[model samples]
Target: MKKRYILENSKSLLVLLVLFFSSCVFAQQNNTTPIMENQFWKNVQFGGGLGLGFGSGYTDISVAPSAIYNFNEYVALGIGAQYKYLKQKDYYASHLYGGSLIALLNPIREIQLSAELEQLRVNVNLEGSNSNSLDYWNTGLFVGAGYRSGSATIGARYNVLNDKNGIYGSAFMPFVRVYF
Candidate 1:
């Protein structure tokens, strides 16, 4: 079990790393903001991840929204919120809700370093068993790195504080992001 877990994490990291590097090739180089000097609106960004899945016997849905203030091209600070729902035929159903505060650094146009503090609530209930439900709160710090370009980002993080049955499921998580 341990070996299989390690292998899966390795694969997830490898894939995220590849996506990051590929995006770097097309990283933006626009560093001009003479007119918008220190304008809050001009230095803000909004983005996050949205996910939807349907399988032969299950359904998944999620939404994460975030906002950032670019201190400069090299640094940013942000906050985010998330919600997710999962249902499996005749098995179980679960919901995850969370929020996070984030810090990011960009040494180059294509590479970014990320850090975040997260708090989440995970609730689970077996099908047709509304009377018996389990819920808990999970808090953790995550450090990660990613590749970023004009409007897209790919990254991975390992929870510094992880629990086997935690909201994240595992210490390792990979994410794809889009910004507007």
Candidate 2:
């Protein structure tokens, strides 16, 4: 079952990547920051998100490690890995693991348009007499706009494939990002 999910999503992911890069290739060029040839580090960015929760009732934690490469001022491509865990006392625990591909378009300073695709596997275990684990694919496509300044970014995204138990958890997800 897991293998079928991966195989099906793999084709979809590949098609999306091809289309995304083709669009980037045709983006109109504008006067923007010039790349520093001597430093490859300058063209690369690294950042993601960390989520935490601690209390008597429930706990949630997540971490994502990401990298973005600036092909030009108007276009950037990125990738990340995500891991999330949630537990509810005497109830259930869920684990989510995924990889993401993202593209960012900056038509003007301080404004960003973004698109992302994620392929994830979610495992849910219910604590009961017949404890069982369910594994399935949770694929998400997110599109939104953002405000970017220096190394910080704030954005809101809508997941088109918003499933009730998907990774994003809702149709809308707010984001705060930093790149180094």
lDDT of 1 by residue, 1-180 (tens): 553464355456546755774586347346747664447678889998889999989999999999987879999877799899998888889898988777888899998888877767789887777566888766767888889987677988878777675566789888676667
lDDT of 1: 0.78
Candidate RMSDs in Å, in order, are 11.7, 6.4
User: What TM-score do all the candidates reach, one by one?
Assistant: 0.73, 0.79
Candidate 1 Cα outliers beyond 4 Å, as residue runs: 1-38, 128-131
Once model 1 is optimally superposed onto the true structure by TM-score, how far is the C-alpha of residue 2 displaced, in angstroms?
Answer: 23
lDDT of each: 0.78, 0.83
Off by over 4 Å in 2: 1-12, 15-39, 129-131, 165-167
Candidate 2 per-residue C-alpha lDDT over 1-180 given as tens digits, one digit per residue, 9 for 90 to 100: 654575488668778877886797567356434563435467889998899998898999999999999978889888899999999988889999989888889999799889988888899998884857788777777898989998888999888777565556479988887878
Best by TM-score: 2
What is the alpha-carbon lDDT for the whole of candidate 2?
0.83
Worst 10 residues of 1 by lDDT: 2-11
